[model samples]
Target: MKNYLIALLAVVTFGLASCGGGDDKAADNQEATQAVEQKADEAQQQTQEADNQANDNANQEENQEAANDQAAAGGKDGKTLFMENGCVACHKETEKSVGPSLKEITAKYGEDKAKLIEFMKGNAEAIVDPAQFATMKPNLEITKKMNDADLGALADYIMSIK
Candidate 1:
């Protein structure tokens, strides 16, 4: 009877140890699952950030393209810029006011757009009315700062007047 009791107690102890091991395994598995979930969440957040940055870059590129298109449309933008930049205050389409008229300018410069552009840059002599060039010198401060597209547009609008 004594030996039988000892054998039974040993079996019970072994059984309890095995059951506790199973619970430990379950806890380990739960921790592993939580770790994997955290990693997945981090990856998802990174992907979303990358997507947002790409969209912002694409939008900026689109805005730049639209600006380029508008600048290239010289007829509209050029005429508008010309009037807004105070060219209308000195120059006119027909009659000469503070400077030579557009007709006089076109007749003098003719098809030589190079000379016209050069005059704006303050590099060439004024053939339209050399005597009145001193009065126009102050205006070059404004024209010299203009980009080529704007200057071309301004010239186009002026030439179109005739």
Candidate 2:
């Protein structure tokens, strides 16, 4: 009976020691997994931040290019030039006649003032009314030398006529 009790105690001690190591291994594995997850999360966050910054830079560049184009076209205040250049003779603010109106011009060109100047330069066609432009061939000869800045200003004015 005494030997049996001693053997049982020895086995219990051995089992306890073996169980302790299993808990240590489990804790180590859990810690390793948590660290890997943390590193992955950090990497994902950094990538997301970089993507956002890149997107911001692209947007800013696009806006600057647009501003440069508008500046080249005399920007938003070109109306005074349009009135001085006799453009109003063939065109009205909101109505059409021998020529289409300023409202129609804005609808055709939106705020792209450079395109308006290019059309005046004869580098482009009048998209709004190709037929009406045939009536302006005589005027085009006169307008060819009117200068880009002046023409862009006139276009800007037309865009803002409303």
Candidate 3:
């Protein structure tokens, strides 16, 4: 009877230990699963951010391309061309700097846009400031290379300054 009781006690103790160990293993597995899930979430968030950034960059590039295409199609106005070609450095709408003012040029041309275009093309002589022809020679060279449409736009802009 004593041996039987001892054996029963040993069996119960082993069973209890096994149950405790199983609980500990279950807890460890739960912690491991949570860690894996958290890492996956972080990776997903990073991927989403990267995708958004790529989309933003693509949008910016598309906008820039559209603007370039518009410019190529002669969408640039005369004022934009004037400023781009450095005309504003020497001339102003009402004030004269190194060159005659737009108002003076317009007054001299007097609704004659063709004559102004000719002068810009270096075909006609300078009538507004003949003595300043030497200073205008370089600018005339630049204008001489412009297309007729651009020259017409520039002339129109000058004529409208009054």
Candidate 4:
């Protein structure tokens, strides 16, 4: 009877020790999982930062290109002035929109750049589409504010369209 009791006690003690060891292993596994998650989060943050940096670089390149184009145009290119002055909203190269097409204006002017400049300066009447003069009247106010050089550039760009 004594021997049997000793053997049972030994078995119980061994089982308890094994259970304690399992809890430690479980804790170690949980710590490893948390570490992996932390590493993954760090990697994701780095990737996001890289994407932001790439976007910033692209924006800088675009700004540089725009500056270079402006310089190439001698401070103000005719086409740039035209686009900036809202001419593109109405006068496309070939197709008409709210007003006459640039091609139509070019055909009417026929290298008469001075007349075109005069008209933009509001010194001359609308020869291409006199019917829509009222629609363009408000825009003339904007052009009337520009200097002769800018007006000439705008007229040159309009006349150059095929």
TM-score of 4: 0.54
Per-residue accuracy of model 1 over 43-72 as CA lDDT, tens digit each: 999999999999878965764564467677
TM-score of each: 0.53, 0.49, 0.55, 0.54
lDDT of 2 by residue, 1-162 (tens): 999999999999999999999999999999999999999999999999999999878965765565467677655334444566666688889999779888988898887878877878778888989876778666776557776656655665666554
Each candidate structure's count of clashing pairs: 0, 1, 0, 0
Q: Is candidate 2 or candidate 4 better by TM-score?
A: 4
Question: Cα lDDT for residue 154, model 4?
Answer: 75
Candidate 4 lDDT tens digits, 76-134: 85788878888789878899888888899999988798998889888898898888789
How many residue pairs of model 1 clash at the backbone? 0
lDDT, candidate 3, 1-162, per-residue tens: 999999999999999999999999999999999999999999999999999999878965764564465578957656777899999998999988899999999999897989999999989999999998898889987899998878876776677687
Question: Which of candidates 1 and 4 reaches a greater TM-score?
Answer: 4
Clash total of candidate 3? 0
From the highest TM-score down, the ranking of the candidates is 3, 4, 1, 2
lDDT of each candidate versus the true structure: 0.81, 0.75, 0.86, 0.84
Question: What is candidate 1's TM-score against the reference?
Answer: 0.53
Question: Which 10-residue span in candidate 3 carries the lowest summed lDDT?
Answer: 62-71
Evaluation by TM-score, superior candidate among 2 and 3: 3
